[model samples]
Target: MNEQLIHSKITSMEIDVLRAVKQRTLEKFTEGPSVERARLFFLLLPYFDGKHWSGEIEASAKTVSIVYAALHAHDQVKENASATKKQQLTVLAGDFYSGIYYQMLANLNNITMIQRLATAIIKVSEKKASFHDGLDRTTAELDRSVQQIETELLATFYNFYGFDHYTPLATLMLSYIRYKDELECLQGGSETRIIRSLNETLQHPLHTERWLLEKLDNLHDQISLTINSYNFNYDLKNFMLHQITPHQHRAEQLTREG
Candidate 1:
């Protein structure tokens, strides 16, 4: 959120991590370079809360965001049989980011957060794998996986800093964001593992659309309920609701028409 502060912290550590991961061979072979901002904000949340902030903590957080970028990069991989250069790099991106996170934590002797984040990654991976598993999951089961994938890393960081108060709000909002994107994908005729699973489960794209609409409605209700449960101040809550999950009248119209 604070660009100067986060950029100052992120630029210093990101440069070092990039330097360490640099292999003249790999650099030449790679497709793109850099991290992302949404992830940076979640990583810096504890710092914003005035937690036990430090260079080591900030560096660790960057690696965590890098890890998310890695996974996210891979999630872009096409289901096509012929993988492109970008898709190939995506697979390595997640692996490379993971190695950097481990190395950074190891250098700092922050073995505990390493273990915590590793466990979080395992949960995230399993949930991600569920979408590709061809398993017949109910809407509840699918929703649970989505929640874990969105919140596991942030939840680990929150639990580490005794900032568990943010978990409920983060979980709700992130899940909302994810489902919102999923709905857009549905409307655009794009295929995602979740959309495919829903299609298979529902037996038609129309049913998939209905399923997604209902799912989003439920997630929005949950978000509202969970946000109210948090002790966050008015401004923070307003920012999340208005900025993050601003109500889309068009989306409501589509849902109603469906």
Candidate 2:
């Protein structure tokens, strides 16, 4: 599909997801479910590449996104701080979204998928907890945790549907997107847990910045090489490269800064 059409489909899917998990109190107080366009694109990548797809698969994908939103809401809860009403509602919103996902899957009679996604959620939660557990993780180990945290649910969805070929690409692209967000946060003088962990590991924000820049460049290179190995159409390739993961080299960035 063309880029515009691809985007249109993602937006439509986002609307469906929002509709699936809409709640009045959550909508009124907390930030509603954040269905990222990039994630939706990756979830629908198999369909966009002309693989077998059905209404059931689409519903399963929506549930995956809902679960992500649920986890994200919990992630927003403050650490070691008294629970404000917003935080309390955020926790409730997470649970509420979790229930919606389970109910959606049950309605579709996708017991296997529900089980698989539950396992994926367990893995994701474990990796997320590692950030607080002070396990003395190396930077590489932490990177792996980040990768699993970002892609495990989608990976489970893909594996359940026999689209394992997209796993590596999704891992690379999602990790790159995540680090890009972290880099932006660093540059903007905002510290996220990921940034704090990296700073602790690398021993300085400067080192963290350098590492993130190199990581993005490396991921972009891998994406370029990996994209060629797949039989993606020109439009799909273009959309992924230019739209979803447009890259600027560190050198280019420096030159622009100069």
Candidate 3:
């Protein structure tokens, strides 16, 4: 697909997903879902590439976005120490979005994808919980968890639809984005679970910063190699490199400045 077609499709999916999860009270109180445009791009990549796509598949893709929105809603809930009105509603917003995903799938009669997504959610939740378990995990071990938290849902969707070739690229790109956000949070002094977990694992904020910078560099390289290995069209590859994954050297410059 050309850049316009790809971008248009992604924007359409974003609009559909946002409309799918809208709620007046939740919108009023809680931070809305953190549906990254990059993530949505990857979710719709198969369709963009003209894979085994159908309306059912496109509808399923929307539900996958809904699932991501559902999970991200819970991530907005503040720590138990501060249960404000927004925080209370944040939890319910997650549940409400989750229910919407289930109902959406049930209406499609897509029992198989529902089961697969449920399994993915379980694994993602387990990895997320490990952050709170007070385990002295090595940086590698912790990163694996973070990678799962970043990629499991998308991986599940890709695998279900025979788009497994995109898994490595997806994992690398998604983790890169997650680390990019974490790096930004560290610089901004924002408190987040990923930041706390990275601090605990790395033993210092500086070390966490260094680790994230290095990881981003490594992921960017891997993403380049993985994308090159695939025979994607010029437009797809260009959009991915220029639009999705950051330039690692530039990212390092910014991180060092911070």
Candidate 4:
């Protein structure tokens, strides 16, 4: 399929997801559940790539997205601070999305998937907690934690549906996207849990920036190599590179600056 058509299909799935979890009070008070487009693209990648897709598989994909939204909502809840009404509503929204995902899987009679997702959620929770647990982790360990946190649920979905081949690409792209966000947060004079941990580990903001730049360059190279390994058509590959992950090498930037 062409890129536009692929994007259109992804947008359709996104709308369906948003409708599935929309709540009046949450819409009014909280930011509501985040249904990210890039994530939706990855969740539906198999379908996009002409894998055997059923309605059941589509439903499972939606539930996976809902799970991510639920976790993202909970992540927005402030720690060690008094809860405001919005904060309370945000918590409720997270719980509400969690229930929606459970009910969705239950309706589909996907008990196996539910069990698998529960394990993935536990792993993701543990990884998130590691950032604040005051335990010293090596950069490799920290990268693994971040990878699990970002892609575990999606990886679960991929594994369940025999699309595990996509896991490596998904992990790299998601991690690159995450580090891109962290780099932006740092440049914007804001701090996040990941940034704080990274700063503590790397020993300075400058080091963190350098690490992020090098990581992005590495991931982009991997993505270029991995994309060629797949049997994707021109439009699909082009869309993934140009739309999902446009990269500019840091070394090239430095050379031009010099």
Most accurate candidate by lDDT: 2
Model 4 scores a C-alpha lDDT of 0.93
lDDT of each: 0.73, 0.94, 0.87, 0.93
**In model 3, what lDDT does residue 34 have?**
64
lDDT of 2 by residue, 1-258 (tens): 898899899999999999998888889999888888989999999999999999999999999999999999999888888988888999999999999999999999999999999999999999999898866778999999999999999999999999999999999999999999999999999998888899999999999999999999999999999999999999999999999999999999989989
In the range 1-258, model 3's lDDT, one tens digit per residue, is 899988898888898888888889888887786678998999998887778789898888889888988898887765565877877898899999999999999999999999999999999999999988988888888889999999999999999888999998899898988889889999899867878888987789998888888888888888888899988899999999999985757566977879
Best by TM-score: 2
Ordered list by TM-score, greatest first: 2, 4, 3, 1
RMSD of each: 3.7, 0.8, 1.9, 1.1
Clashing residue pairs for model 3:
none
- Candidate 1 residue pairs in backbone clash: none
lDDT of 4 at 60: 98
Q: Could you tell me the TM-score of candidate 2?
A: 0.98
lDDT (Cα, tens digit) per residue for candidate 1, span 116-223: 998998899999999988779987788899989988988898787677887877787787778788889989988788888777778898888777667667767777
Q: For candidate 3, what is the total of clashing residue pairs?
A: 0
lDDT of 4 at 211: 91
Candidate 2 RMSD to the real structure: 0.8
Cand. 2 Cα-lDDT: 0.94
Model 2, runs deviating above 4 Å: none
**Residue 140, model 1, lDDT:** 78
Q: Tell me the TM-score of model 1.
A: 0.80
Using TM-score as the measure, name the better of candidate 1 and candidate 2: 2
